[model samples]
Target: MHALATITLALAAVVAAQKVGNLVPEQHPQLSWQKCRISSNGTTSCSTIDAEVVLDAEWRWLRNANSISNCYTGNQWDVAQCNTTASCTSTCALEGADAQSYRDGYGITTTGGNTLSQKFVTHAAFSFNVNSRVFLLEPGETNRYQTFVLMGSELAFDVELSSVECAINSALYFVAMEPDGGMARYPTNEAGASVVTQFGEDNVKQFFIQDGKRIETPAASYPGFPDTSGLSLDYCKSLPTNFQDAEYFAQVGGYARHNEALRRPMILTMSISNDHWANNLWLDSTFPPDRAGLPGAERGPCPSWGNGPAPQEVERYYPNAKVAWSNIRFGPIGTTV
Candidate 1:
């Protein structure tokens, strides 16, 4: 799991660098979670753990450590502030978030229990926040990320999307990431705790919660796969998709390779975002503008311009949108169900 960078997420890609600017004063949010182990007899033992979260470097404020000038601004590096990559790394610091900063500056809030709410757009008197993403961290170690192995395990969590309008995505998932955040390999990666540099989110769940009720669509609801709601390698291969990227996914490794990633240790992440680059069309509307009438092209009812840039329709239209997640549980496969 990783911090939400810009709401405009890219296609599949690896963000490897250990964020050169994390050396500055940092503050992480305290989020609670529970870990459970189930016995063969169906008994369960659970422990409450205090966890922390870190914002992705992309969204953190990067300023010259000694002065008030910006180290990187307007999507480009300030050469005077950072003459070179190495120099910039040592000179700039990525500021961390406090309680007020987390809410007003990033639209993030948490309670005493296991819950985190991320807002799509946050507006205050002097500042504005568009979207947010954060990664889970180990309870005691601020620089270390918490890890989970989910092959035979199940993760249960309730999500409230009543405020998450169309074209908005409030997602949570697991990814294979180094527990130490690649700090050992990249000595300069102070914030490399979890930046998502490895395999993508192949093993994941996208769900919504309503009025605290269990919101679920039975596999029986889909006429195509009436017998099973689960997806496997066979299902992916049999499903027809002419998208070039989908083809490339098969050429590189396909679901088989992606499936194996689930057997490894993974980090959990969550976010509420909307696409500024693609308008999230790929997730909910006709993509490629040119493929409007093609099959698999018209995926949702949203107009091509449905979710515009943050300053446009997205912010102006849904300033009050948000998503709440709570009642999280993890245990043996059937135990949670």
Candidate 2:
């Protein structure tokens, strides 16, 4: 009887451990991050800085439909806007290849302070894309905002999509500078004028963990554009409405196996979230060629151009396309976000 009781206790302890391992991450109450910044002289001289961005605080409107008007006027923000929208016309009009149309009627507002939320317009004809933006943490600087991730550094955040159906092509990624100090822009001279090519395949790496599976690849390797084509239903279904942890580590040394120059300094641009009408816009144009042949090679819920659903149909089929990110933290490899 004594031996049987001891065996039962051991089994109970194993079951408890398994339960603990299966538990998901609890939401963090506060978000914080730190990084090292190079001085304006562009030398090795640097300073370690710490900063906080209110993930749960009010987020000011960074850009809106009216903001796109600047695209036609050749303004400072025009270049960035045009690149992001993949405007086909020289004047950056709303109609053309890979063009995105905007209606001021749609906008996102923070709900409950801690969660950033947006409601998609029910009107069939109204569609638009906006990136709720945030700048990199560069404390105490006027003209220069320079920060870089070294080997063994990690970037992490918790995010969730409202609904996979509504968010056709929603994504989160990091944009950074090349070793030459030049920032990559969209619409490269490639055949499809792919955005990933313009960003320089080596300059950007996206890491994602979905339903117990981990996927890490360069943005350019994603065939056409960074849409939802390659993602699995289990992955999409798993996205939480509240925050869930995601991360990317700066493995420059790993990349240096291909290009040695990456061992030098490179500046980090801001992280971003954008919504789109097509879930797999750029799945056909992957780098290294192998990614194009992966399973679900021709799979995604979004319709083709002429076959797309009407406005009302779209509203009914894909409702509430938004994603919220919080608990953004970055530091050494073991740092938690």
Candidate 3:
């Protein structure tokens, strides 16, 4: 095994809301990240950052490598001048342009429907303030597909990139994961059919961290945001009648499930307001659970009138930091709001 040193692009360490108690600095602070400072201009956020990613692949030429002058000048002539200078018409190291010459390549999708693309490793300081109120890729509780693999736990929720853009950037610098990691996954079956309707009571306890030591304040209580002290990551059946109209919300009794096939841990942040008329912040003690089996399996019989079986309470992360929620949504993927 040999180690090749390469530097092609500038990098980042997004540090916008890096406050005191909201972060777990002692165990997982900035190590080797590219600096990224992204904010808003008006209603839209046009932020940019230079990031370097490390490529951990075998011998192959990159598209960006073509711009390198030294490697080309030295190797091109020797490749073209094989024997006859009069017949030398190429600038590469081999004959028969298409047969033995190198060409750029892309990753192939496997039989399992998963594509093996660029792999991004996050080992640096990173931060961002997205345009939406909830930092979710989708509007409601629904299932979506993500290409990254997430590992580690708690203060070390590290994310490893495996996409084309990530691979190209990985060739440049070392990148670390943000505290919450990347995308959330919805659990699936053998045929890839969504199991959203499969929630029940028996499995509600499996998704939560009840007795574990408190990591930090719930990310929902980040200063100006509402309080979310007792909500748990487990399955929730109902919502307060007063909290009925929060924009971009999951309605009570709505069928939702997570796409767990990606195997990435998600840090879902939510904001609750007391004023039923407008969005006001209020912390709820109970939260939803991961529905894994037949839809409505654990929910028992349906309610006669309102919605859901009944109202209940659960534990959740409080004291919001970068108040963000999982990318999971309600309804099918690609469906419009």
| TM-score of each model, in listed order | 0.80, 0.38, 0.18
Best candidate (score: TM-score): 1
Error of 3 at 214 (Å): 5.6
Clashes of each: 1, 6, 72
TM-score, cand. 2 vs. native: 0.38
Model 1 per-residue lDDT tens digits across residues 1-337: 2232211112112223324333334557778876777777878787778877877556767788777678877468899987866677667755556677787788888886677888888777766677787878888776677788776677777767777776787788876667666655555454456011112234333233445554443342333433443455544654554332366657878887776776788888888887767877777778867877765677677767633344367767888899887756665554443
* Residue-wise C-alpha lDDT for candidate 2, range 85-182, written one tens digit per residue: 33322323121111011112223333332333333432325333333332232343211223544444455555675463522444434434322111
- Model 1, residue 44: distance off in Å is 3.1
The digit string of per-residue lDDT tens for model 3 on 1-337 reads 0011111111001111111111111110001211112234323121222111122111112111222222123124333223333222122111011111111111111111111122111111321111111111111112121112222111111122222110011111112222222111111110010111112222211122224442333333223333443223322222322233232324432323222322343322212111221111111111122332322222222122122211111001111111111112221111201
**Which candidate order results from sorting by TM-score in descending order?**
1, 2, 3
Q: Which pairs clash inside model 2? A: 223-285, 223-286, 224-282, 224-285, 225-282, 228-279
lDDT of 2 at 173: 41
Tell how far residue 165 is off in model 2, in angstroms: 2.8
Off by over 4 Å in 2: 1-134, 140-146, 164-167, 178-279, 282-319
Q: Give lDDT for model 2.
A: 0.31
Error of 2 at 290 (Å): 16
Report the number of the highest-lDDT candidate: 1
For model 2, give the 10-residue run with minimal summed lDDT: 189-198
